[model samples]
Target: MTKKRKKEKFYVEEGETVADCLNRMAANGYQPVRRMEEPVLKEVKKNGKVDVEVSHQRIMFEGKLKEE
Candidate 1:
């Protein structure tokens, strides 16, 4: 038979804020990751006026997420 990988469970007590939860996760040996912001596009011009433009953007928190 193949072996199963172990996973740790996360839980919150009576009351906790986002900061508190993050702190708990750090205490448990979790790493912080960088966040990605939406991209901006340059406006196009037509007949010396404003024209249409398209921009693709996304928000991502890369790497493993911390739990508390």
Candidate 2:
């Protein structure tokens, strides 16, 4: 029989380091399997035209439960 796998998302908090997030996950018996980052974007319009586009980066981790 094969063990079922589970996935969960973790968001990095302000002032928190990636290592800190990984350590916290380890304490909860979960290990990070993937890393993902997406851009948070917004458009600014002025005088019926797009003036500028702004973007920010969001970091997330996908974790799976550790096998005993």
Candidate 3:
């Protein structure tokens, strides 16, 4: 059988809560080791100028394989 990755990343999908993501990780035989949030950027044009702004935050979790 192929070996599974020791580390994996899980993202909180749209309309999904952080707790839901954690439960998903557990179901996949992984435990969360770290949590992170990255800003989703968007560009806006006003007065013939372009500006960048944060649209939202994307939540992610780094998971480690659970030991048997």
Candidate 1 residue 21 C-alpha distance from true site, Å: 1.4
Q: lDDT, candidate 3, residue 1?
A: 79
lDDT of each: 0.49, 0.83, 0.97
- Candidate 1 Cα misplacement greater than 4 A, ranges: 1-6, 31-68
> Which residue pairs overlap in candidate 1's backbone?
none
> Would you list the rank order by lDDT, best first?
3, 2, 1
Error of 3 at 50 (Å): 1.1
Q: All candidates' TM-scores? A: 0.30, 0.71, 0.94
TM-score of 2: 0.71
lDDT, candidate 1, 1-68, per-residue tens: 65322333333333655466556656655544654555556688888998657565433332344443
Candidate 3 lDDT, 1-68, residue by residue in tens: 78979999999999999999999999999999999999999999989999999999999999999999
Q: By TM-score, highest first, what's the ranking? A: 3, 2, 1
56 Cα displacement, candidate 2 (Å): 1.7
Model 3 vs. true fold: TM: 0.94
- Pick the TM-score winner: 3
